[model samples]
Target: MDSEDLAESVLIHLDVETLIPGTLKHEKCEISTTRKCYSYIKKRTFATFVASKRVSSSPTDTSPVWQCCDETFSDPSSVHKHVSNLHAEEIEQLTTAALDQMLSQSEEAFQKQEDPNESQSDDPASWIPSTSHLSEEELSKGPGEVLLYYSYCQIRDPKLICSWQSELCSRLHLTGKVRVATEGINGTVGGTKTATKLYIKAMLSHPIFKIMQVEDFKTSEGGAECFSELKVGVYKEIVPMGVDPDTISYRLAGTHLEPEQFHKEVQSLLEDASSKNDTILLDCRNFYESKIGQFKNCLAPDIRKFSYFPDYVEKNLDLFRDKKVLMYCTGGIRCERGSAYLRSKNVCKEVYQLKGGIHKYLEQFPEGFYRGKLFVFDDRYAISFNKDIISDCSYCGAPWDQYQLCSTDFCCQLVLSCSSCRQKGLTACCPVCQAKEQRSSSSPSPGRPHREECECTDSRPRIPNDTL
Candidate 1:
């Protein structure tokens, strides 16, 4: 069948049933499957589409993204130079650019410079109308704290919107990315309170924010500063999962454990429960997030993207269903939707997840049932929730990313590895993971050759693309 016909056939034969008395997990499976197919096709055609329009570009290539494990390089120096010169070049470029922009922007407040009014309009973005907002005593009434969170919404009015972000950001100084769209806004912005308060006010008053329950709309469980930046903008939807006409479901359908309680329960399971079990522990986190830590017997799906998760779970439901299935994600966000979806399909016998995710678990355990750092999409690299170091890399097997990847550039596999491996080379999480060389802004540099094509397998189900 043609791609379109295949897509339809794929969507059929998928039965989504909520195990609860009566409920339906939004046929998110169909929506996600369709998107995955389109993405596959898009990646195949995007280059052609671009090449058709431009003659100056070459077939894209990239530096091999590597994941190191027990791997100790005989050529450490060579690998270091290769990493520093080859893979790290563009990372340096972006950092340098960001630094330059910050530096140049800091050279403001000219005295008797060119034109006086130039200050007014030329730097409208810089202008701040001063006002006596709060007293030093009140602002200093309490010690400052950190706030990490995911916040998204659509932009209704920019005159009110852009300034809203700028004003609060200027005052509180949180850093993140945001998008504005007619459809709606979606982004995870994080920062300090003084700054968060700026955007918080607008959201607190919006209708969309109101629609979500106290848990989702206002998930303030993890202690301050789990997130480092706060950015606000407009986007079509907060999360970029594509839209399809699949009837999807989103409702409570799990043994939701509070953060502290979940922490205790996870520990209890690890100590008392069998690591070798008929039940399956499923980490609903993206590949990168799982690289850091997961339950003892959990099933880590080799997926880098969150949008692809439902599809992965659908494909693997057979392996886990009939068994006691415990699933979880960072902030319980995915489980909130994922568990409900799974039950809709009768995929697992028992479904449960931590209430606030590892973020909350960390607060209670101080150390945790899992180990290592938790990779976040934000700039903090990862938050170290567990004191124990339980994971290592899949490649040479030294350490894991606490974040992992696949081999395809389009699938620039996110995976886990140790610090030494992360320093030595570039590779995605599993061998099944895609190598990202060809399509990334950075091409695979030939500074170093592979000892052999990576033969590692992620503990997860899929095999990584082997072309890196």
Candidate 2:
């Protein structure tokens, strides 16, 4: 059968829902098979059409004017039905043009597919946009770039949010991790600039994230293949502060201090002798994160993880009983819950947090009070804001801030190692891990070495052996 006849037969076998232009319910539609067919055909046709028009000299001549209407249907049958019923004239025109071109290029197209040496064009229009799933502006942003962003808000159903986010991220070719919880969503995704921007727009458009703005997103530039894969999951809490979301309410948390206000507060506390004694600048990040970079005189807890924050707070509760506690974290989500936890315990006279946290603080005041490198969770690992090097090399006593993973097969701990020490093959975080690596390397088996116990538990790379 001909292309038009085949399209009609497919449409006849499939069910299409007719609805008002703006009243389609995306959640109710299940168009798995039809969507696959639509995507495949759309890509093939658009690619061939763009290739055929690549020789046009005029800018307008090269641009293909698509006549598809604004209203989208995920199912191919639904799209065909919509075109046949509402846009009969346009469908007939497209069908005729597309079929004619397909027939003329049949030989060349088959040859191109078979020839391994033939490279595909890098033009934007060569690949069809998933317009049914994204906006025109989003599609115009193109691909092959990356961005980073996060959000915190109330989420009623974390699992449901996870499912939706997973689907959206997958469709957009995004990677990175997302944590959904009752309190909100905490995510760090890396994708094409277009995909990431659309993800943020779609998120802000959702009812749950209506309060969020574009400025709330913290972005970073990277290649399109920054992250290895995407991971969207549901958790008890986004930041894992070990506090009940119901008990410690973020709405009643500490007062938010902007970058300038926070800087002034820090300066005033340092200059004012009397108030300096009463005020406490607390670092609400993990020991590893704060060890390299922190505000001078800030009381950063020497804990392993955020889960240990509660115990540290309980032990130091007496110290904050009459003091004004000022807390800050990497992004501010942790501080929201951390400050709330402290206030709920009635341990401080007043509570305050740095709005947007260290990330924003550095953006505003690159040469501010904060010193040393700021630890991050991405592949870049750490970033330096100032010349201060607070951390020392794990193997050697020389000052260093660069972090490297333990050289062992299984241990994933991070350690500060100077260039000199790294050159000396002292890569393991601890002696135990070093021994493990040595044993694995000396083993006879060529495949992945057998698992061995190493004392390296967390990201911190303190020496496990007493002598070391």
Error of 1 at 34 (Å): 28
RMSD of each: 23.3, 23.6
> What are the per-residue Cα lDDT tens digits for candidate 2 across 33-56?
222223233333433322322333
Which is the leading candidate under lDDT?
2
Off by over 4 Å in 2: 1-152, 442-468
TM-score list, all predictions: 0.50, 0.65
Q: List residue ranges in candidate 1 displaced over 4 A.
A: 1-146, 150-172, 178-187, 197-202, 205-237, 240-246, 252-255, 271-278, 393-396, 399-468
Best by TM-score: 2
| Residue-by-residue lDDT tens digits, candidate 1, 1-468 | 343442233222211112111121242322112222222222223222222222222434232222222233333354443433333333223333333343344345223234322222323233332325865443323333334334322334534444555564545444555554433443455544443444455454444343333333322323225445545654443444332213332332456667766665555666765633655667877665675667665677777566676676566666764666666777665675567567666545556777666666666665556666665565355666456665666667664445544443344444555566656654564434334333445555456553322334335445232110
Model 1 C-alpha lDDT versus the unseen true structure: 0.47
